[model samples]
Target: MDRFIECWNGLDDPRTGNAALHDFHEILAIAMCAVLCGGQGSVDMGLFAKSKEPFLRGFLRLENGVPSHDTFSRLFRMLDTEQFRAAFQRFMAGFSEQCEGVVAIDGKVLRRSFDSASGKSPLHMVAAWGCEQRLVLAQIATDAKSNEITAVPKLLEMLRLKGTIVTADALNCQRAIAQQIVDQGGDYALALKGNQGTLHDDVVLFLDDPASKAITAEPVVEADHGRIETRTATVATDIAWLNKDHHWPGLAAVGKVERLRETAGKTTSQTAYYLLSAPLTPERFNEVVRSHWGVENRLHWRLDVVMNEDQDRSRLGNGPHNLAVLRHMAINVMQKDGEKGSLRGKFKRASWDEAYLARLLSLF
Candidate 1:
């Protein structure tokens, strides 16, 4: 736990005078442990601290005794989100090696974090998830979904993107975002859509042309959950003519993936286009594109379904965003755990077994 303390010790406490009874790092440490063991909000943190006071005191010095739920809530409300996020990044830097492979950037909403009386919308967060590492590299909270365009660049600035391929949905396929990715020594596979205006139109027109005859990969087929799916990836590297017209930054190739799925005898098909900074093989393109969904399937879904994130109603001040960071930290720790079981199982084990919880804390 010394490693964990070293990273978070840099955070400046917002509390002052009599309000600063508990040590900032100790409260943060307790909160981290609570979330890792299935604690949801301030109440859970307080209960967990009280119940596990002995286990907590092994590493933390609770000179002021356990803090109340109100203390946990107030600290998060007043905490500077930017500093907490930076501390989270610092902690992850020490916890893992250099980030590599597909780093998927996406946004998720804290659906219930809005305050009806205060007229606030749900908190929207843009997160960069390292697919190979299965950890959140960095995140930024935006006021709305449309702000993701602005929020994404800020999120990118916090990451070490060298030698990584960043992927994002059509909403984030802006020219500046693409340029930023290339300028940072990273490649991009941004989805193409109508939002790109003429660029999207030209790519679709060219790829759809019969004479284009793009190189196609052997169709991949999979069957599961009472459904059969087939995906075929096609790539066209002869984009010099297109580049001459658009001059997109680092433009090397364009790609198309056609997916056909039959579920309950109902057939559905989707065709997605991409702007690539490098010419990737159809197979490699398939891998990169498929890995992008890991941010949703592995991170977003788990947060909402497994961790009950959306149901959390912490709608005061910085509470929502700060708690979101804690959730990400908990996930990173648990994902790094080598124990053999599902995440849900790990939470149960951690909650019931203090030894196992200590083992997880030691990962940092």
Candidate 2:
């Protein structure tokens, strides 16, 4: 809590005048706590504050009592989003482990946050997920997925990625983005597609060529959910001949992964190519590829299904983005809580058991 207070105080409060009653720290703390207890928007946060007044008072003074839902909404609307994100990055620095494994960068949309009258599309957020630690290190908001190509560089600048492997989809396969990762002392494994025109075609041609075969590892197979899948990964490091035509910065090697799947009497095969900065074995490349999906299945899916992020109707000002930050904080705390039950169960315990809630929040 002290660390949180420090981060909060570091922010330049956008509010002025005698009209303000609730402390900024108080509102932020209340919102975070409430969300951890399964509270959704400002109304739910206000109610949670009222119910947990005594528990809140244990750490906060609450000189003017709890703020109303309107107060919560208005303050967040005017809050400085960049400052809020910086503060979150500072606060999370305490809990982030050494960033060594795959750090997957992905984007998600706040579906219900669109405002038709104002001509505002849904908010798209790009997040950095630590696959090994199961933590959301940082996030940035963009207007669309195309904007992610630009947002990814800024987002990468906010995180400590030295000695880490960054993975992204085909949308982020830009040469500049890959160069940015390398410049930061980090390695990249970016997905390749026809978006790069001849570069993609050349790699596909090389991997398909019988003479270019320089196999590094064996294929991995899996069977589950009434389906059997096979993945064969190979790395080609001798790109000197190809480099004469397309000069990619820090391009150590190119990778190819072939997937074969059979389910319900249907069989399909697909091949994916990647640009690599790390000289990885086929086995390691396969692991990194699989870990990239963790951001989708673990973070995005959980937010939509368990945290109900897409259903949230808080699009005013900073409300949607700020609330999303709170959700990320709540998830980090809950995941670190070491509870044997599911996330929904943790929310239930936090709501029903103040002592349990205290224990959970303390982990933050």
Candidate 3:
């Protein structure tokens, strides 16, 4: 808690002299606590502050006696987004251990944040997900005109990914991005699709050719939730035979994964390829590639389903972006909480049990 407070203190106060009645740190503390306990909007935050006044007073001065819902909305809108994002990263750094497993980078849209008056579309945020820990490491907001490609480098620049394996979808499979990962002391496992024109064709031809000497692995089979699935991954490390015309930076090998699924007597099959900088075995390559989906499942899905982020309607100024950060922080807090049943269950407990809320806050 002390470390988080210190980090929050580092943010530049957005208010002018004497214009602020409430302490900036206290406001954020209340806001974060509210979100951790499943408060969705500014009104919910205000109500939470009022209901938990005693518990809040124990730590916070509450000098102004819990700012109004309007105050909460205004403060969040007035907050400097870049500084707030940096502070969030710094705050999360205290809890982040050494990153070593698969780190997947992806983007999500705040669906209802578009403002017709301001002529703004929905906000697009690129997030980095820690697959093994099931945690969100960092995020950045991108403009509607631009895509994740531009925002990805900025997000990568903010993270410390030494010894970690980073993965991304085909949109991010650029030569410069590959080089950036390797330059940052990390390895890349980027998906290869039609975007890479000739390179994609070459990979497909190489994998399909029976005469080609490629390393192959036995198919992995699984049965779960009334479905039977089988996956087979193949890696071709010997890429020197390819034409020298298309030179990919840090490219060590190419891989292909075939998925066959059956349900209710129906069957389907699909194949996907990847460009890898890490010299992983065929099996490990499959594992790393499969782990990339954790970003969609663990982070994006949870935010929409569990936290109701998609249904949230806070679209003014920095409200959408800042609230997204708060939601990320809440997820991290609940995930760190020991003896958790479900995320929703933990949130309910935090709301009703002050002791549990205190324990959650203690994780700092």
The candidate that achieves the highest TM-score relative to the unseen native structure: 1
- Model 2's lDDT to the true fold? 0.87
Runs with alpha carbons beyond 4 Å of true place in candidate 1: none
Candidate 1 collision pairs: none
For model 2, residues 183-253, the per-residue Cα lDDT tens digits are 99999999999998999999999988879955657778999999999999989988887678888877888
Per-residue CA lDDT of model 3 for 1-364, tens digit only, reads: 4755877756887877665889888888889889988899899999998889999999988877887788889888888889889888877877785676899999999899899998989999999999988888999998562577888999999888788999999999998898899999999999999999989999999998878778889999989888999999999888875537578887888899999999987999999999888778989998998899999988899889888988889989999999998899889888877684988888888999999998888887
Global CA lDDT of candidate 1, please? 0.93
lDDT of each: 0.93, 0.87, 0.87
- Sliding window of 10 residues with minimal summed lDDT for model 3: 1-10
Q: Single out the weakest 10-residue window by summed lDDT for candidate 1.
A: 1-10
Better of 1 and 3 by lDDT: 1
**Model 2 steric clash total:** 0
lDDT of 1 by residue, 1-364 (tens): 5787788766889999999999888898899899999999999999999999999999888999999999999999999998899899888887666879999999999999999998999999999999999999999999899999999999999887899999999999988999999999899999999998999999999998978957899999989889998999999999999999999999999999999999986899999999999889999999999999999999999999999999998999999999999999999998888667899999999999999999988887
lDDT of 2 at 221: 90
* TM per candidate: 0.97, 0.95, 0.96
| lDDT, model 3 | 0.87
